[model samples]
Every structure is written in structure tokens, then in C-alpha cells.
Target: MKKIVLATSLLLLTVCSAQAQIASAYAGRLQSVLDSVGKRFHIKGLSAAVYRPGEGMWTGAYGESYSGVPITTDMYFPIGSNTKTYTSCIMLKLQEAGTLSLDDTIGKWLQNIPNVSGQITIRQMLNHTSGLFSYTNDPGFFTALNSDYTKVWQPEDMLQFIGAPDFAPGTSWEYSNTNYLLAGLIIKKIFNEPYDVTVRRMILDPQGFTNTIIYPAEKRGTIPHGWTVMTTNGPLEDMMVSANYDNTAFLSMATSAGAIVATAEDVAKFWVALMNGKIINSNSLAEMKQFVSINANNGYGLGLFRMRPVNGHVVYGHGGTCFGYLNENMVDSTNGITIAVLTNQDSIDNNQIFNWVVTALHKNTLQMAPLSIAGNEKADDIKIYPNPASNYVDVNLGTANNAKFELIDMTGRNIINTTVDGNYVRVSLSDITPGLYLARLSNTEKGILKTTKLQVVH
Candidate 1:
């Protein structure tokens, strides 16, 4: 009996150790994904965090905050549009308390000028089924915004810019910032206080989210500079100074639509807490997940986006894009894994990277090869004949047989996929466009074994 007990104890210990290692490995792979995204997007900085149910959190930060300042895990980012999620949470909490209902019309809450805006239901506003014209899409609004970025905008002022409803309320779906702006107005009317005050009290303070801030007034100390590129191939310019704007004005204007600033870890924690039913009841969460098709390809829930990537993996989250920042906070409801990616740059599609992160985390066993010096050495062995191939490229993998090669473009799209049978593989780049690409070599079982930069020149 004693011998049997000792053997069982040893087996249990080994199993626990293996589990810990697996968790660590997942964390490593997540970091690699973040690094790759930052490089590909040409972002000034990228900060991300991943949280597993029982395992602790893991954070990864890459690139510079400024010209020389390296980004840290604690840096703050403007979570544009993600503020809508928080606002929706507040509305749900109010519903739970019987103070309000989702079916309530905007006319019942606030004395609005526009009949169409007032007739829009709260549910329609939250889910973006409201037909209100997006104020952000207005040419006059952009004209004013570009002229004076520091101009303080009141919610009432924004209403003037919204010309008319696209259609009747709830008839169709469109992503309108005006809907969220009105929602913010309703919150203020209900609580008899500023929307930011209510958010801080109900969400930020209770959750102990120290890094999250609803920018009340413009002060730029801890926050990293926001950046924007003129074109896909253009250099990044500092919007803070170049645009001659204070973030406070932009924050005030964005309010409940796109104003929340938070670090990656805090965003992940917020999503995890919400998913675990710590914020609202399970019923509210269910309502939030009750998705309606925004288009044939995409779906929208209450302040949340339901994404079905090419891999067919479903994730619920929000993507935020302000003047100079783009962010994504996603959750895998099945496994309770949360991923938050925050960047201080604009115009890049972060969904592809976020989807990859979700797919990798969902797999039973994360099949990733070493992405360090060892992997680089293996990549060095496989040589491409021309440093910059014009039409065709020859990859000499030497003894690396049965390896699969994938040529991925800068947009995170796989442009080519072929298999290597023997020592050498010839690839025709005649049809391929002249640009940058990543050549990834891997096997069926080991996942990505090696990756190298490949340049195509016309």
C-alpha cells in the first residue's frame, strides 16, 4: 500500500509540472505573436496581455514608446470604441436594478432635438441597429476636427453634425458613433452626473483598474504619443504635436463612444471579470452575446463584436480606433481566455493578429517550434539564391525535407503555400506583387519551424 501511494504521488507531481510548462509555453507563443504584429504593422509600440482561467497573466511589450523609450507592459493606450462596451455594461447594470430597460426609447430619457434620434430605442443604440447618421462620417465634422483638434466638443454640438437617420430605427444595422454619444447622454441624465464619473465609480474603482482613465481634461504625461501614417508606405508622424491638438478635446468628444484609456493587462482583467459574471448577472451576459448579423460576414452584440475568422473560430470582443491608436480586446467564451492588444498607431488591421492569437490559444496543444537563435540558425541553412528576387526564387532547404513553405505578405495574408519534397524547392514569384513578405517554413506537426524576411523587387 505504501509503495502504491508513493508512485501515485510521483505521477501527480509530474502531471502538475507538465501543466505548468504548457502554460508557460502558451505565454511564449503569445509574445511571439505580439512581436510579429508590431513589426508587421510598423507600429511605434504594441502592448498585449493574455489571461488563462487558472494560470496567471502574461504580458508582452515590443517597440518604442517614443523615439528611444522602450514600451513597457504598464503603458496606457486609448481604447477607442471599447468605451462602448463599458457603457453597455453600465446600462445593463441599470437594467438589473430596475432603474431602466433596454426597450426604453431615447425620448423617454432625454429631451432630444431630433425626432428620429429620440425615437431610437436603447437596445438599438447599444447594438448599433440605430439608424442615426454617424457624426464622425460628416465632412463638416472632419473639416472642423482637422482645423482645430483642440476644440472642445459638447455632446449637443455633435448632434448638429448628424444630418438624418440612414433608415428607421432598428430597421438595419450600421456602426454609428452618434448612437453611443446619445447613450452617454442618457447615462448622464439618469445618474444626474457626468458619464465618466459613473464609469469610474461602477467599473474602474470596483475592479481596482489603476491604469484605466477616462480622460476628463487633457494632460499628457504618462500616455504614449499617438501616431498616424499618411499612406501604407508612409512614415509615422506624431499626432500630438503635428496635428496641434490636445487629447482632452478628442477624449471629451468621444466620451462613451471611444474615450477610455487603459493598459493591456487592465483591459484583459476587465473582460475576464465581465465574462465570469463579476460585473453583471449571467442574464445580462447572455444578452450581450445574443449576436445579430451586422453583415453576411460579421455580427454585433451589445457593445461587442462577434468575429468568425477564416479558421472558423468565434471570438467576442471590441476593436477601437481613435486618431492615432488602434486596439483589440477579445475573449474566448468557451475556455475563458482573454487577449488584449493595444498599439499606439493607426490604419493597421489588428483583427488578423488577434484571430491568430485566439486560434493558437484554443488548440489542445500549442505546436510551436523555438523562435530564438536556434530557429534562426535553422533558417540560415535554408538559403534563397537571390537576396532580392525579381520574378522567381529558389529555396535550398538542404536536408530539411517535407517542409511546408508559406509566403505571407505585410497584411498578414498568406500569399503562397507549397511543399518541399527534397533538398531544394523552386518558387515562382512572377504573379506575386513587388513588396515585403515573410517566408515561413514548417512541418505538419511542429508548426512554424523557421521564418525569414524575403524582399520582392520589380
Candidate 2:
């Protein structure tokens, strides 16, 4: 028994060593991506993280908070609409625990709003299918918001500005802040506690996400300076340093809809863990992924966005934009690679920065060594050798397992496909063209086991 434990410990150490090696290899590339993007946009501050399952994570920051105050990994930024994901997860967890049902109508919790109908389901609200009017769309709300920048608005107060519903409940789809605002209220109604408290107790504490906070209600002292233009079509300025500038009005109104303040690393960690079924159960995750098509390339899931493809990899995450913060986070569906990009300047295009970061990270993934794990198994158990091969490459799956091995080109075309029944399988590269290809090994039952880049040489 002791020998078995020792062997497992050694294997774990090797896995960690490999992960560290890959992380170190990609560190400079990630930093370069962040710096280049920040410089191009003249961003005041930016931070990012890329998490690769079975490999490791790389976090970096570029530019300054105001002037000489450099942005660090620990600095917090309000992750705008990305907060909706947390709110949705909390609701799902409650449903899983038999406390509530997604089909429960909003009328059960909230009422007496302007045009919101009690018939809107919690699931509809989560997926933005409720067609509820967004309070932020009303210019009058902004006037009142700017009237007292420090004033804390309650969830009920913000509902007064909600206009008529765009469409009836579950008829169509539209993004509405009011949907999540009400969702938060329902959470509060169910627990009789502040929604943020429930968020912390249910999600943050269990995940060890100490760097993240539900904004306004929970405060962090080391938040970096957030920048945005005072008026539309105006020059950008530091909102934090400006006199009489307080984020209370904006964040308080954002509430569970968009007020989570967190570091980029924490954001990435949350996405990776959530997708890996650490935050929610498999059934809940499946429900979250039931996307309603938003467009040809994008869709809306429960508080999640099926974003446009980033370098041929379809990712799932949400983007957030607040007064002076813009953030985009994604976890690759194919590889489970998670990337998060956050900028203190709100005016810049988050997708552009996110795309650039993804491109760089994608390149880094291809360059890293081949190492991956089967379901809940140590990655050291599997090994691929003679990577740059002329005729063939050996795939040792560690133990007798039913799996399929395939070599796919950079264009996503499969070149070689075969099944493995034993501990080892030799993939034929003799007929394949000499170029870079992705080697994938997937279990018949458990899905994709491991994927790594292979260089097929003549």
C-alpha cells in the first residue's frame, strides 16, 4: 500500500512538473499579447489569465491603474455582465438543492413592477427569453443615477425605470438587465439574506474564490482605478481619481446583474471550475448549456454566451461592461482551455482583446508538450512519443482502455483515425502530409481523453 501511494505521489509530481514547464513556456507569449493589446488601445490598465486543464495557468498584467500605479494580478475590476453567470449559477444550485425550480414564475417572488409580468419563468429570465425591459435603456435612469453617484439604489428602486416588455414571456429573446436584477431579488426572497451573501456562501467560499466579491455590498480596498468617459463621445478619464466620482450608483444598480468585482485570475478560475463541474452538478451544467440561438455564430444560454469562434475553438463564457471596466472570459468547449481578459478602460472592444489573447494562447497550446488525462485520472498515465515523426508515433494510453486515436490537421481535417484496445497504439503518419497536426485520444464512453499537437515530418 505504501509503495502504491509513493508511485501515485511520484506521478503527481511529474504531472505538476510538466504543467509548470508548459506554463513557464507560455508566460512570455501571454505577456506579449497583453502588452501589445494594451498599447494598441492605449488602455489604462489590463489583466488576463489563461488556464489549460492538466497543464497550468498563466496570469499577466500590463499598463498602469492611473499613471505610475502599475496594474497587478491582485487588482480588482467590476466584471460587468459577467456577474450574470454567477447569479445564474446560484439559482441553478438552489434548484438542485430542491429549494426552487427554474420553471418557477417571477410573480412568485417579485411583483408590482412597471411592465414585468409574473408569468416570466426563472429559466426564461436566466436565458434572457423573458423579454423584460432593461432599466439601463431608460435615459431617465441615468439622469437619476448621475444625480447621486454615491447613492445606493435598491433592487426595487431600479425597477421603476423598467419600460414595457419587448415581447411576451418565452416568446423571443433579448438581453435585459432587469431579468437578472429580479433573479437576484428572488434569491434574496428565498434566503431572506442579501443576494451577495448567498453568492459568497454558495459559490465563492466553496470554490476558494477569495479575490472575487459581489460589488458595493462587499468591498475590496485594493481595487484598481477604473476609467471611462464622463459623457458619451468624450475623452476617457479616470473615474476613480475624479472628484465626486463614486461607483456606488452604477454598481448598486448593476447588483447581481453586473456587479461582481474580481481579478482576472479569479475570473478564469471560476469559469474553468464551473465548466469542469466543480461549481455545479452535471445536470445543472447541462441545463446551463441549453443555448437559444442568438445568431449564426453566437447563442444565449443560462446567463452564459455562446460566443463567436476564437481561432476555430468554440468557447462559452460571458462579457461584462460597466462604467469603467470591460471583461470577457471564455472556456473552450473542445479543450477546456479557459481565458479571461479584463481592462479598466470600458470604451475599448473587449472581443478584440479577447480574440488576440486567445490567438496567442492557442499558439502556445500547440507549442507545449503533449500531456493529458483521462476522466479523473492523473495525466502522467498517458504518454505520446516521437512527436516529430516520419512514419509513425506511439500513443501509450497507460492501461488497457477502449479509446479512439486520430490525427487531425490544423484545418480541423482528420487525417488518421483508428481504435485502440490495448495499452499502446501506433498511429500511422506514412500517408499523411508533413505538417502540424493535432493528435486526439478519446475514450469511447468518457469522451475526449487527451489532445496534443503533433508535427508530422517527411
**Top of the candidates by TM-score:** 2
Q: Score residue 316 of candidate 2 by CA lDDT.
A: 85
Give one digit per residue, the lDDT tens place, for model 1 in 115-221: 35667789999998888888777777767666666676776777777777798887888888988988888888889888878998999899898889887542333
Residue 148, model 2, lDDT? 92
* Candidate 1 overall lDDT versus native: 0.70
TM-score of 1: 0.71
lDDT of 2 by residue, 291-366 (tens): 8988888889898887656667667889888776779878766566788878766665566556655556565665
* Residues forming the 10-long window of minimal summed lDDT in candidate 1: 1-10
For model 2, which pairs clash? none
lDDT to native, each model? 0.70, 0.76
Off by over 4 Å in 2: 1-22, 231-234, 371-449, 452-458
* RMSD (Å) per prediction: 18.6, 11.6
